[model samples]
Target: MTQTVGKRPAEDMTQVKLNVKWGKETYNDVEVDVSQPPLVFKSQLFALTGVPPDRQKVMIKGALLKDDEWGKSAPKEGMTIMLMGSAEAVPVEAPKNIPKFVEDLPEAEQEHLETKRFGAGLHNLGNTCYMNSTLQCMFAVQPLREALYKKASGAGGDPTGRLVTAIAELFKDLESGGAPFPPYAFLVALRAKFPQFAQQTQGVFAQQDAEECWTNVMYAMREKVKDEDGNPVVDKLFGMRTRLRLKSDESAEEFTEDGMTYTLKVNIEEKTAHVSEGVALGLKEERERSSVAMGRTVVFRGGTSLTALPPFLTLQMMRFFFRRDNGQKAKILKKIPFSLEFDAFEFCSDELKKELEAPRVAYKEAQDREIEAKKLAKKGPGPSAVATASAASGTLTAANAVADVDMKEAAVASTSAPTTSSSTKLSMTGKYELVGVVTHKGRTADSGHYVAWVKQSSDGTWVCFDDDKITVRTEEEVLQLSGGGDWHMAYLLLYRAIMVDMSGAVPAAVSEAAQPAAAMETEGGSSA
Candidate 1:
């Protein structure tokens, strides 16, 4: 079936003629649709030149055509368009190979073949369970997994690029149905880049913290992995732009700064019982420093606010602390419960909240309509149902209308072309749902077993990845990971944004929300 892209219907399409010029070749009278989005035009160019939409730079009359806009200067009949992009050589499709007949094989061979057809686990190389667990959690990110596959297919020969390619290979092995295999090459590449992972004591590799390894691996990916347009893929998914505001009662000034972070570190305190409390504490802090405004030391209250939220959010629970007596990091077995659905609206700045309000309202209305439709569906078709069929028909029609809008928005979001603005491409609603988690089981941070719990996309059930052992777990059992005892407690939580049905047209609110954070410092020993 032919898919209709963009907001306009097929009947509204207005085709025009344009002359396309690439490197050394010029094609005359190419058909162009003026009614559709610019991305559609780029896709047509890709088919002709073998150049991906993200890599193509299409210019008409010296004005660049953006993925999100059609531009004020419209294309006319027989207009010349300049396209500059390198055409990538396409790989030929390979024929599938047939495996040996399972029925004629021995019982053990058949069993092995059966297990290989299922999702394969990772073999623990010594105390490498931490790495295995982290890998599993990372693989749970569908977008990241997809990106890794693309990188593996057409990656550079650099060390970081090799590392990504190796990871993709490992992931492919795991998914190809079979027994657990050692991620030897991936580990070698990782240790080569970050020597800290190769630490040893008495000729034996020592156990390391999973969070540290996770941080380092993510840092490497952020530095190396890029989309077709050469933008960091890691940052586009997991990075957040934050603003730190520091205020003091003794001074009439606030010092503010903006920075990027991949994860939010939540410090577990004595009074912390839930993850939300820890997150709240993580956003605010008190520090005593020399106040330049007062010419004396004074206490300052500092708070961090989200300037922009990414599609994926990572929260690291500070479960370990350095013990002064033992000189080792000890774990905090405090019981902290985290909700499946997290609302980050409260943590956002006032301006961001205002910007998110409309989208949130739209999402809530859509959900309510769905719920009403479900209720009507459950009522069944009887005499009573027939009595209110006309009334219920209206609700169903409205729900279908909302679904149509949502489908169009999803198409826009799934486009591979780069948008004019990154903020507009992000989640409209500051809400997320827990998808993947890394948990620890031991008392000390230095030596503990790590496990990954990931929600399967096919079925909403949770699966536990324990090194070479894999088990299906219920949602309730997964929630029990909230620490109260020595059992596995969540260490790293990955949340995916709950997508809101909003299109790129809503930019006024987004730009208004993106205004730079206010900052005021002592100017010439006095407030301005």
Candidate 2:
């Protein structure tokens, strides 16, 4: 008891709205104006679905039915439309009344039938029909056809056929259920037609091939070493039987081994080898020493010729021999061994050893000269001292002496004085003289303020002094003073006299001069 609403054949359906759920998370509401007769709706459907309009599915849909005017009045409330098309029902041609049997068919014909059945099943199930189409096309071609021919003739097919069949059957089942094809299978079919996809797959395979190549090379090299019985030698015995000795022109005493007496040398340039009697005995003794070192038994089969050895092996042997000969010296030197084409082994000779120690000898000599200079400086004044003949004739002025004493007291009160906690008590004194007037007070009585001056002495020492500290005498007093013209020089003279007198009062034993003359010279130089 169902009623169907059919389309109105002659009425024009101008506007139709289609609600489409396009893939996951996407929906579209499309309005189509189909004012013209014979309107094609597949392109419009794809436009509504957001699928490419020119894609195969849209083309196939269009081919199925170019126009279906009967769909005009179809109930449009979420009703699905089925495009009108003829089913793939080919006319069954009579085979001239011949009887049919599955086993009687030719092998090729039987295979074709089997493939068609599988392809049809895949199409019904909405499986990867595009991929199935490709396979059918491949089977129709040479190699694949031959392969199928062999398989049908009982020549046996590879496991790949079974995989392909199973994939086709799964797609067929999904199509039958009206479900969309799986994205992965759809992609596989799409990529087969796209060259970039093949390149990506090939790239992955290429990386695996490279890794396999390296692994094979390592295994082949490791297998090359074998024992006399043709079995691979144990890891412990591999490379254990080889020994190399270096023979140099130097004397046997110049090189020695810890537990062996052998001394052998090789002249690399001349390709000559030499062995000393001690070296011969040492080679025999090395067997026992090596056995002890390895904590196992070792037999010395007499040394063999290494003339055709590789350069790498030769260089390794040279380093081994060098270390055995002078391990301690080599460690101290931390030398890097190189080819004779570069520098010679100059660091290993006796001459080089002496040259290395020469610096220490020179250092000791310089230290002795320093000690001698210190001894000389410690001796105060030598015996031949000249006497001042008129020393008592010159009278010391009390005023000048008092001024000098006051200046000395002022200097002692300053923080610049040296401490006497140590044995050496250093005292520094200098004579300062005013050379230029940078600022001067005016001659007015109220302008008798302090003025600054630059001063220099015969030895070129200059100092600035405040003239306010000096006593200003009247013109009559200045006339009485014979040396008043250079008032700054007089002040400096008084200062030096005060320092000299004070020096006399301090104990001579505690003086810096009590130390060596070298110490006094150093103290004087530092004070300046």
Candidate 1 residue-wise lDDT, 226-297, digit = tens:
666566667766776778888888885677887778888787899897888888899897777788888988
Among the numbered candidates, top lDDT falls to 1
Give the clash count for each candidate: 2, 19
Candidate 2 global TM-score: 0.13
**Which stretches in model 2 have alpha-carbon errors above 4 Å?**
1-79, 90-143, 146-528
lDDT of 2 by residue, 229-267 (tens): 333211111111223332222222122321110112221
lDDT for each candidate structure = 0.68, 0.25
